[model samples]
Target: MRQRPVNLMDNPHADRVKRVAQLAGRSAVRNRRQQFLAEGPQSATEAIRAHLGFLKLSEPAQQMWPVGETVAEVYYTQRLIISHPDLFALVQQLPAHVFVAETSDQVLQAMSDAVVHQGIVAVVNMPPHSLQPSPGAELVAGIVRVQDPGNVGTIIRVADASGADYALATAGTVDIYNPKAVRSTAGSLFHLPVYTRVELGTFVASFQGRIFAADGYGTRVLDQTDSGMLNGPTAWLFGNEGQGLNDDELRLADQRVAVPLYGLAESLNVATAATICLYSSAMAQRRQDPSTS
Candidate 1:
């Protein structure tokens, strides 16, 4: 038999409820606590699965704490309990260390950052700074000083979907854990290692691969660029939306590559450009070694 959810939390202003709500509105609270809010059913489901996966890891692996310490607490409305019974069932499978609770609609609204809370939210621990891309990573997507939270999250999603080994945000980039950003990821954040607050110079030095800068005024066109160059390990750098890559940032890349503009459209959105660049590399890499596909 499935265990019933805890009693409803009806007070929107309860101390505990307020603290969770603050995570969405305040960066200081999140940084100090090393936690962020995963709003909606999609994020909540992924967070729960990550926590459960953590429990199954070997003792030594668990010590590394990669994805296991992900979900800290989950709060859902009565409607969610009934509407997403499957999700609730997954929540029931969580061990005693995880907190699961039922909340009133008003309490859920107060706890959520989104206009539509989707009747669920999970408090997720930020992966430790020590967490990094796997040693043998073949393709990586990097964004430098990209201020839009939505773009950051979307790029992470694209990187995951395109089968890139990992994603990263340079120090000046927007917070990947921002509520809007987290919502935009659509749960891909849980699928891979996404390093944040990284330094571009250090990242470039650490990789033994070709680096391509996605620039509007580059000498090489993405579609026309040598396929052989992208067949090996590669890292892509996407710059800020408005200014693109600065002179210094562009100098770090082995090549500045531009996605060709077929029509009168001014330029592609950073996320859209990333989709093309990453997919191109993914396809080339898979062709080079079918086993990786």
Candidate 2:
């Protein structure tokens, strides 16, 4: 007996109605549907460029593409009805393999999470990242037990801005693929390399340079720390917001520095602290260089 192929083009309206009527959470999107949501034009662009294998594209994003040009294959929507033409035009020229959808709502609902879905979303083939340490890349940011996706994405953005080679996240950290995290980076997710692991202390010890840990309670202030101490390749370890650095992890630090709180606030958010620390280190490195100025 021969089985007939089901046409996606057939009964398009019914397919769309069903998808819009039923939607699931972001986490469930991966497990139940075997798909995860990557929102915003920029994130969608990065995921496409990375060749992470985006399964489909939403209707409203048919025209909007990234700025620069690259030849990469991706599944994209064909119907081009965009309110923002300029933005859409830029996205149109990218290296995309287009797929005309049966209906907009079906594609929209299939890719969206809890938050309002950006006009564009992609179902990407998620690659499992390795936790092993890298060679020759000395500058590192260790996020231990930071739970929020927004904070995690912000830190990754700061790390990329500071030219840090890669980020190492410990167990109990937020899911890096969370839509909120992906959005907060504003496309910095593509610029940085990230990894997750259970053992941070062992990884930090393996690196060659000064190990600095950021803590709110530390007596040594970030500004007051000897600038020369960060001269060599450095690894900066930042901890959780509410609990601060765990006792065993703190023991690995060669220098523990604190960001001073001038106002009534008890402590800075983990992401904010990461931005300051990474920039300060970058400044120190720049000052040491002759050609940068």
Candidate 3:
């Protein structure tokens, strides 16, 4: 005999439900369990799609899904109401490794990091990050200490859109996999490769080409700098959100280039500055080798 899927609507306080909810606020639990919650439909969907190396089974959803040897499970609450139309069809087509659960809206809210969860939450395994330079990488993004989850997620989205090779989120940066940050990514988290907790100086020293720092008051402006400098393999270093890059970090860069500001606005935000810098380099690289595009 086989086990049938159970509908969970009234058991918000169940041991299993509480365990999944722990991933939302507790890093220690996440670390111990080696998993983080991917809240909402877009993130939950992509969490299954990305095939992020290893996944563990949630005891509840295990019988219906979590089929593979390593076993991957995704918990979906209120989505059980409408997922049958599309999301369910999508997951059905995916490998049996993907497991889903149908639960109450209350359970989804409980598992979410936010007050409003968009009716889905997934506990996804965190992949191990390796920080080596991207092979044949044209442009790279390096993030250090910048603490805002939204900024970090947006910067990654920009880097992906601008066609940067890869990104390194240094030690002090907020958790890239945090539920709020994952929501901010809006699916780009699966599109881009983001390596975490890298050391700034060691990475810069080993990089094959020039490294540039985006600074507010630097000796060179984006347009003033030679286009040739942007053509080669490059790394762009962005620093702490408020204080900006420290002296030691700036010294690691081959150059510090500032984006021109004509408006009354005091300065540029890190994500905006990073987008401009990455686009400038990407366009320059495209010009250098038209066929590369």
lDDT for 14 in candidate 2 is 66
Candidate 2: C-alpha lDDT = 0.62
lDDT of each: 0.84, 0.62, 0.72
Using lDDT as the measure, the top candidate is 1
Tell me the TM-score of each prediction against the true structure: 0.93, 0.75, 0.86
lDDT over C-alpha atoms for residue 194 of model 1 = 82
Worst 10 residues of 1 by lDDT: 55-64
lDDT at 73, model 1 = 88
Which pairs of residues collide in candidate 2?
A: 63-88, 64-88, 64-91, 65-91
TM-score, candidate 1, is 0.93
lDDT tens readout by residue for model 3, 6-92: 665557888788988888775567767877777777776666555532233323223212333222566555455475445554444
**Residue-level lDDT tens digits of model 1 in 1-293:** 33666676989999999999999976668888999998998888877887878334333234323454777888888787689998888878876666788888889999998886798899988776665544356899998999999999999999979987788888788888899998899988877778877888888887889889999999899889777988989999999999998999999999999999999998999999999999999998888887866
How should the candidates be ordered by TM-score, best one leading? 1, 3, 2
Query: Once superposed on the true structure, which residue ranges of model 3 sit more than 4 Å away at CA?
Result: 1-5, 52-71, 78-84, 94-97, 130-136
Encode model 2's per-residue lDDT on 1-293: one tens digit a residue.
11221224333256543442232244544435433445656676665554422323222111122222112222223332364344344345333343223235445544455355456654444334443555446477888888888898889888877878777788778767677777777776655556655477667757777788898888898878777866568888888878988888888998788998888998899889988888888788777876765
Best by TM-score: 1
Q: RMSD of each candidate?
A: 2.6, 7.8, 5.8
